[model samples]
Target chain A: MWRGFSMRVVSAFLIGLLFGLGLVVSQMINPAKVIGFLDIAGDWDPTLLVVMAAALATTFLGYRLVLKRGKPVLDASFRLPTNTVIDRPLLIGAGLFGVGWAMAGLCPGPAISAAAVGGPAPWIFVAAMACGMQGQRLIRP
Target chain B: MVEFTPLSGAVGGFVIGLAAVLFMAVNGRVAGISGILAGVLTPVRGDWAWRAAFMAGLFAAPLAFWLATSEKPQVVFDHPLWLVALGGVLVGFGARLGGGCTSGHGVCGMARLSRRSIAATATFMATAMISVFVLHHLAGF
Candidate 1:
């Protein structure tokens, strides 16, 4: 059990590191870049689509490779989401996320990763994300 | 005007996604931004180190990368502090209400072939599209 917990922690750290690196390399850390993409009148940037395509390809390939092994390298099997039905929470959350992203052009991943840049936006985003989480906890029934 | 490269963004996303899968497979945890952010919010005894370390890596990796590559990254944001702050708060709230974010749903959850993640990701993408449309097309803000 101890070993398992430690393994999770290590993996999480590594993942977070790569994520931050990706944000830097892709320049997704820049809200202007993202906002520029959303800015249709001012050249209509589509860099974000490239990021999504790249991410999807990587995830798909990784899933295929891992699933082929029939067993994960970790302590337990992969925990796929069991819920399939769509509902109001999903819709509202997505809408809100879009609105926030449209306004800020910084989603959670890039926002958190950009924290390394030590800018005003990332810090603000992290704080808000936390409050949102805590607020949910309070409202959870 | 900054040049946008589709290939670079895609490659970056792929690498990040691969890293996320490795983290999940080895650690048995979903790469959900909410859980990660939440973990740090109300940390328990002996549980703080890993989370702290993980966050540290986020900042350190980008710095290390810039040093190694001899490249400087730029940040662009035209909004005032108050707008950015509000955006952050909204993201946090949205993630909690939705139960996941891009990392968890798009990369980790989707890799596991999770329905919830798929639905959540779809909603996220669609909402982002709509938000961008409104921001640039109708409102022109």
Candidate 2:
């Protein structure tokens, strides 16, 4: 059991490392680049669009191939999202997230990755994000 | 003007997707950064090791690159500290309430052809674009 658990942990680490490297290589770590992509009325950068398309195509095919197996290598079953409700919270929350994203051009993934190499801004953003997350839990939980 | 980098974007995006596929195959979990970070914050017994390890890997990516190539990833923060903090808060609370962020909903969930994810992605994308337009064009930020 310990061996299996360790293997899962190692795999997760490597996967995260790869994802971070991808973010760096794709220049997603740059807030200006992300904002440039979002800026349709100005000097827009379509690089993010290409990145999204590539990621989507790969994931679309990759998930199908992976899920065809009976179960995961380290787990008994695939732990996928079960929720399908398109409700108010999802819409409102996502909209709020969008506003925040445009304001700073940093989402959760990039923010975390950027904190490693960026200045105090990323750290401050991360700390505030934690507070927000905890606040939500307190309010809802 | 923002530089176009379709080649690196596609390459990096494919790598990101590959990491996500590997993670799902072995760990049977979604590679959602916000959800993963939240789990680390309020860790439960027997479930925190992998999450911590994944985050450690993310942090290590920059260090590894710096050691190997002696090059740090570019990160720009044009917004003030207050806006950054506020954006972080909204993102954290919003992601939790909405149930997922870009990686979970935009990449993985959409790849699996989930309707809820699709709606959330569309909604966030639209709002983000609108917000950018308002901020950059209308408000002249």
The prediction achieving the highest DockQ against the true structure is: 2
lDDT of 2 at B130: 98
Task: List, residue by residue over A68-139, the lDDT tens digit for candidate 1.
Answer: 655566555766556767778876876676677767767777776677665766788778767766776787
Tens digit of lDDT per residue, candidate 2, span A89-127?
899888888888888888888888899999899898899
Clashes of 2: 0
Q: Model 2, B2-121: lDDT tens per residue? A: 698999999989988888888888898888888999999999999999999988888777777778889888889877889889989998998888888888888898999999889988
State the TM-score of the second chain for every model.
0.86, 0.94
lDDT of 1 at B111: 67
Candidate 2 Cα outliers beyond 4 Å, as residue runs: none
Q: All candidates' lDDT scores?
A: 0.71, 0.88
Say what the RMSD of model 2 is: 1.1
Error of 1 at B89 (Å): 1.1
User: TM-score, each model?
Assistant: 0.87, 0.97
Using Cα atoms, each model's DockQ against the true complex is 0.58, 0.82
Span of 10 residues, lowest total lDDT, candidate 2 chain A: A21-30
Q: Provide the TM-score of chain A alone for each candidate, in the order shown.
A: 0.88, 0.97
